[model samples]
Structures are given as C-alpha cells and as structure tokens.
Target: MSVQAQGREIRILALGDSLVAGYGLARGEGFVAQLEAALRARGIPARVLDGGVSGDTTAGGLARLDWALAETPDAAIVALGGNDGLRAIDPAATYANLDAILTRLAARNIPVLLAGMLAPPNLGAEYGAAFRDAYERLARAHDVVFYPFFLDGVAAEPALNQPDGIHPNARGVAVMVERILPAVERLIEKARS
Candidate 1:
C-alpha cells in the first residue's frame, strides 16, 4: 500500500517508555517506524503517533493519557509497565494503572492492544509471578488484544538486543512487530468497525 492510502490516516498511538521512544537508535529504526512499515506492507493504512516518553512508568502513562488521547487516535497500543517492573513497583499498582488506562480507552470507544511486559527474574519468583499475572488479569478483564510479552523473542539475546541488554535492536523490533502484527491488525479492524 502506498503511504497515502493507509486507512484514511488512521491514527495509532503507541504509548510507552524508552523502548517505544527508540532510546539508542536512530528515528527510523525504532519500533513505531518498523511497525508502521509492517502495517503498510500488509495494506493497512495507518499512522503511528509516538507517545513514548523516556523513563515513563505506568503512573507516568496514566498522567499523560489525556494529552495522548487529544491526538484522537483510532486505536491505542498501551505498551507501558516496563519501568514499573524495573523499579519493582507493586504489581497491584501496576495493574491498577493499566486497568485505568484500558478503562478510559474503552470508554472512549477506542480499540486497545495491550503489550505486556515481564519483570526481570532477578526481582525474585514471587514478584515475577505477580508482575506477569497483572497483564493477564487486565487483558481478560478489559477484553482487549494482548501481546503476552513484548520482548518475547528478543529480550535477553545479545544479538537481538542492544548493548544495554534492555531494549531491542532494529532487527529485534522487526521480530516483535511480526509476532504482534496479527493482534494489532485485529485492533485496527475493531477500530474501523
């Protein structure tokens, strides 16, 4: 699909933290760009709005939701909670923040695709379990599309991730886009409906 024909310029807000901000990579090499290219390749006319803020936690996302939604995206991809996990914040708080985001989006009649995050194992088994479960609970409760783990195929692999061992490299982001595209496509379809 040509750039102009992607769904009447359907707005897609990618709200998240450093990874979405493309921390160490050039602008075009980031997740949003790659995801946009992937969507266009699939003939989905869409534009990805960068709502990422470096160092943003779940609370930060909630704080900024009104401003982000002011852009009037047709759909939203909520990719937060990573920094919360890194800081080992309470899983319940994380869940509450995400639930609020999802609830607000639902109230707006905007489709959401929740991108889940996994707490680092160093945080301990109990913490890890609770953190992972929060995503599951929110997804089920909100009935939104859920990508179980954002960094599923790229997280720890030195070849796929950057030297920081946190964010994924361009190739890794491509892998992530491929894995999550189906769910995101469904979100777009829902939004269009």
Candidate 2:
C-alpha cells in the first residue's frame, strides 16, 4: 500500500540486516510480516515496511538511506551494524554512518529506534568493547531511543537460532517482535504526536 493511503497509519520502516529480512525464514515468518501482525494484535493501526537487505552493514545502510526514506515512514527502526561487527569493521566508522543516518531522519522529523548489536566475544576484548560502545555513544549523542542488544534472549540460544547459527528462526523472530513491540509502540505514539 502507498504511504499516502495509510492516513494516520503508523508507518514503520524496519531497516537493517539479515535478521530484519528473515534470511532463513519463510516469507510470512520474516520480521516485517511478523511485526505487522504483532502491531495488529496490539490494536495499533500500523504498517511495517520491509527495508531490510540481507548481509547489509551500517555503511551500506547509509548509502541506501535516501531510497529507504522514500517510503516516508513516520518512524524507522534502525537495525543495521550486525554485518559490520561480523566483518570486524572499525566501530568508529559504524558510529559515523549510524550518526549520519539518524541525523538525516531527524531532519525530516522522523523518530528512530536504534537497534544495537554486540560484537562476539571471540572478536577480542578490545574490538568487542569498541563495537559494543559504538551504539551507546551514538544513541546518547543523538538522544534517540536505543535497544541495548537486538538478540537479547535469542542470540546464543540453539532453539531460537537457525541452522546457520547466524539468523533467527521463525520462533525466534516472534520472540524478538514481542520483546521490541513496546519500544516500537512508544515510537509510533511519539510520531503521532
């Protein structure tokens, strides 16, 4: 459906990496589909735009920001940076890209919910520390809402993760939607105001 048609409809752009794209899950099991269902179940009139791209990094997300914002979503859930952590990219760069994205969205008066990602412990203490702090720094600097860790309960859980051990399975996505729904609802409420 077109953005204009969704009058007073809470338009949410789920922008991020494979998790948001539901990489290993079926069409209906993906984040966008499941999030929309969750919102409906909560009696929130909303639409979730699937702006996820498989294997996308924060830098890549920055490059596509203009196109993604074309949907004119009332708010955006920035779920990127997972790929950056996987690739061990410099955390500073990730922060820069995310900061720019948030700045642009703010310029349009669009609220943002920044989804944070943690660097695996195996990535070493130094890298992990920097990477984990990046999200916090950005969120505080921009004064935007932040979810400390996207995979909070799902991350190392065998049952929740897919065979690849990277992306979440269908059940995991459900858990994520439930966990993040409250924050999302708050964002929508703020946007409406």
Tell me the tens digit of each residue's lDDT in model 2 across 173-193. 998988988788767766776
lDDT of 1 by residue, 16-53 (tens): 99988988888899989999998887777789999999
Q: How many clashes in each structure?
A: 2, 0
Model 1 local distance difference test score? 0.91
User: CA shift at 7, candidate 1, in angstroms?
Assistant: 4.4
Cα RMSD (angstroms) for every candidate in the order listed: 2.5, 3.6
lDDT of 2: 0.88
Q: What are the lDDT scores of the predictions, listed in order? A: 0.91, 0.88
User: Model 2: how large is the Cα RMSD against the reference?
Assistant: 3.6
Candidate 2 segments whose C-alpha is farther than 4 A from its true place: 1-7
